[model samples]
Target: MFQPLAELPPPALGEREWLLECHCARPVTDLLKAQGWDVVADLDCNVHCSSPDRRVYVGLLPESQEAARGELWHIHVTDNSGTRTWRQTFGADTPAQAIAGFLAALIAFPARYCTCA
Candidate 1:
């Protein structure tokens, strides 16, 4: 059984629950999967999703330099030539619902246009 971080109450001080909150990726991954994206998780449990020209990552390690400082969500779109066209990141304390809101907007956005433009 998978439990989403959004449904959990706030963690108590020093609980260290945040360390294991990678489950926060579930809703985001599910959303991408339902939208015909390919979803996969690495051995470390980081979730990656990809469409034809876009990619999304959830629960990336804080130690990863590619990840924003302490960020859990990383999303990007690429051109047909594989150049990055758009990108966004959200920090560790960001709620799953908030990440979902951003992802929903991205998914709803037309792929033929550049959101960054």
Candidate 2:
């Protein structure tokens, strides 16, 4: 059985969990997977989305599931891009704190040579 690890606490008001990443940072994705996050699906981030870049991501499944109803998340990182985006599912009380932490870590660049836009 897989166990959930201590992570960026759930957003203060939502149902999503967030973690930031940067071009040079080693994403905690593997760590999450080790805990319980499963890659349920692959994604084409550039397909019909406002994002101009392309990326391959794996969908994350939460530790909890209610009749197959749960949240999904995706993460991707590129070197020298200076930016990383975290797409997650949030409910009425979005995990704003965790999300903010994720944003802070995701946007932190070596020298401000990247962006999400």
Candidate 3:
């Protein structure tokens, strides 16, 4: 007979966990997935959402660089027509905050910035 090991709890808010470390990024990705969008959470912690038409791609970079200035996020919308719009310095107080902001944006105006249009 063997005993079970002690359980471990998740990290605290201030911990430097990756944006997509667990299911933290699921809310946004799940929504997009339900809408027939292809969502990819890359190894670098960035997420990409694309439409079935392959016309538009929405990329969310929570923290591209480790050593930099402020805690910034880069969000961009690109299309095959060469039309692109981006925000290179969307500041966030923390990774959770960044995920919240990005989720809010996607929920509020997905068509405006995403292929959901």
What TM-score, over all chains together, does every model reach? 0.64, 0.24, 0.44
Local distance difference test, per candidate? 0.66, 0.37, 0.57
- What tens-digit string does per-residue lDDT give for candidate 3 at 10-97? 5587885655433255655666677787988888777777766654455556656621455344445555576774434444454544
The ten-residue window of minimal lDDT in model 3 covers 66-75
Q: What is the descending TM-score order?
A: 1, 3, 2
Clashes of each: 0, 9, 0
Query: Which digits, one per residue and each the tens of the lDDT, describe model 2 over residues 26-109?
Result: 233433334343322235321111112333233333333521463433345544454554444433133434433453464344
Clashing pairs in 1: none
By lDDT, highest first, what's the ranking? 1, 3, 2
Q: Give the distance in Å from residue 83's predicted Cα in candidate 3 to where it truly belongs.
A: 2.6
List, residue by residue over 8-116, the lDDT tens digit for candidate 1: 7786788744432343676676777788878877777677777744544334454466555565577776666777777777777776666776778866876686768
Model 1 segments more than 4 A misplaced: 1-23, 52-59, 66-68, 114-117
